[model samples]
Target: MFKRLRRLRLSSNIRELIKETRLDIRDFIYPLFAISGNGIKNEIPSMPGVYQMSPDVIVEECEQLKTLGIYHILLFGIPSHKDSCGSEALSDTGIVPKTIRAIKAKHPDITITADLCFCEYTDHGHCGIIDTKLKTVDNDATLEILAQQAVVLCSSGANIIAPSTMMDGMVWMIRNQLDKAGFSHIPIMSYSTKFSSAYYGPFREVAQSSPSFGDRKSYQEDPANRKEAILESLNDEAEGADILMVKPALAYLDIVRDIRERTLLPLAVYNVSGEYAMLKAAQTAGIIDYESVMIETMLSFKRAGADIIISYHAKEVAKYLLDRK
Candidate 1:
């Protein structure tokens, strides 16, 4: 006897109910870039929808984000000071610490995940306390600073400390330090499969984190390598990362699916700034219908085994998804 499997494929309602993958508003983490100031809201010309907002404007932005049913946010800060060691990264009055305090005071329910990195704080735009001796990312020194940053974020009411510096043993160092600092409840979301790709153009503009002298090929993963992705994810997991993320999601959906096969941890995919800007530009040029394609891109991320999506498009996608209902 032949079995008929086309029954569920007969209609859209049946297909939806039986859908193996579904995207939701809560599955998103909207990324916010904060600069040191009170009222400035600088629009990133390269990335059509993102902005580098000051602390006061960031609070107002959060209010709009909350109304869109988006519950999670990832933060990147632009400091007022920079040094060879990125000393401001550990400062209590740093851009991120202040913004976290302000946002938490206003929107207590939002899951605030602060990006822990020294790139924005370092005058050279390196992501750690650099080693002038060997001229590379000093793993031990970076781990110490990363740990301190995590605790600072936690003290500022950040629920998650996302270390995007890609330093060796960073997750373990951060976890141990947070535990010692009484921030044991805060989680660490490691940007484990962060690739050194050209796809980060728009982010550099939004974050103002481009290296002053050289590139990050020494630390970020090589895009040509796939097995390295698994190794990186495993390292983060073994080091106590609560969640693992793959950056520049569209190009690495395969990596996302592969990493999904190896870990039970919650996986997040970042629809990076470049990807969003490119899509927005194409839509402006009438190459595609922006809203429809944007939603489809997000659905594709869900289908690719990403448990969370970090995107600048979160608010717009949330609105579109809501209007569809």
Candidate 2:
């Protein structure tokens, strides 16, 4: 009876009827690049159409995204200062804090999530507080700052605090610290299996969070392993991460699917900047239609089991979905 699977694709109606995956505006989380000043919206040269915008211009960007029916946003803030410890990450007066207030003020309906990492605010651009003697990011020292940063982000109206730092025990630390600081309701999205991939290069250009000295291979996962990702995801889940993410979605779809099959928790895939840049580059070269390729790229994540997708292309993809109807 199952002799001919090709029959299913024989007609458009039949193909639609048998379709296992579909794209939606709700599945997207727009990653906004927030800068430290007003009246500015500078483009990230590596990432076409992605910009580093001032708070005022960012509000305008939000309005456009809202009009496209994109509801979720993840913020990466560029602060005016940096230090060895990245203290600005926790400051109520910092770029992230101020931008969260601005976004919430303009659109109370939008779900604002803050990227809870210190790279954007650190001189050395390490994700944690570093120990120069050992030339390593101190796990305990980083957790202390992450907890405070979580509380401050919650106070500033971040609906979700996503810890992209791959530090051990970070989820429990933030969860415990937030609960104790009266922000018990705030959710923590942990980047459980962020691999050290070349796919993050354009993102570094966009967020400007690249390390000034050493690379992040010590903390981020090595791209060569899959079993390690499962172990890390399980660890984060047990430690109270409200959601788990596998970053750089395209190359890591196997891990995304692995996590999806293994856990009940909602899964997120970061369609990282470098991945987007590749598609953008190809589309510009007339190799493929941008909108069609973009839709296919996103729905691939859905088919592989991403419940939410944090993407730089969310706005464009959302608009495409809207026009389809």
TM-score against native, each model: 0.96, 0.96
- The candidate that wins on TM-score is 2
Separate clash counts for every candidate: 0, 0
Candidate 1 has its poorest 10 consecutive residues by lDDT at 1-10
lDDT of 2 by residue, 1-325 (tens): 4658677447987788778998888878999988888899898877899999998998888888888998799998988899999988878999988999998898888899899899888989889989888887998999999989999999999999999999999999999989998888888889998998899898887777889888899999988888998899999999999899999899999999999999999999999989999998998899998888888889899999999999988878877777778
lDDT of 2: 0.90
CA lDDT scores, all candidates in order = 0.89, 0.90
Give the per-residue lDDT of model 1 (tens digit) for 80-152.
8888899988988889999989988888988899998998889888898778877777889888888887888
Q: Name the regions of candidate 1 deviating beyond 4 angstroms.
A: 1-9
Each candidate's root-mean-square deviation in Å? 2.0, 1.6
> What's the lDDT for candidate 1?
0.89
- The alpha-carbon lDDT assigned to residue 191 of candidate 1 equals 97
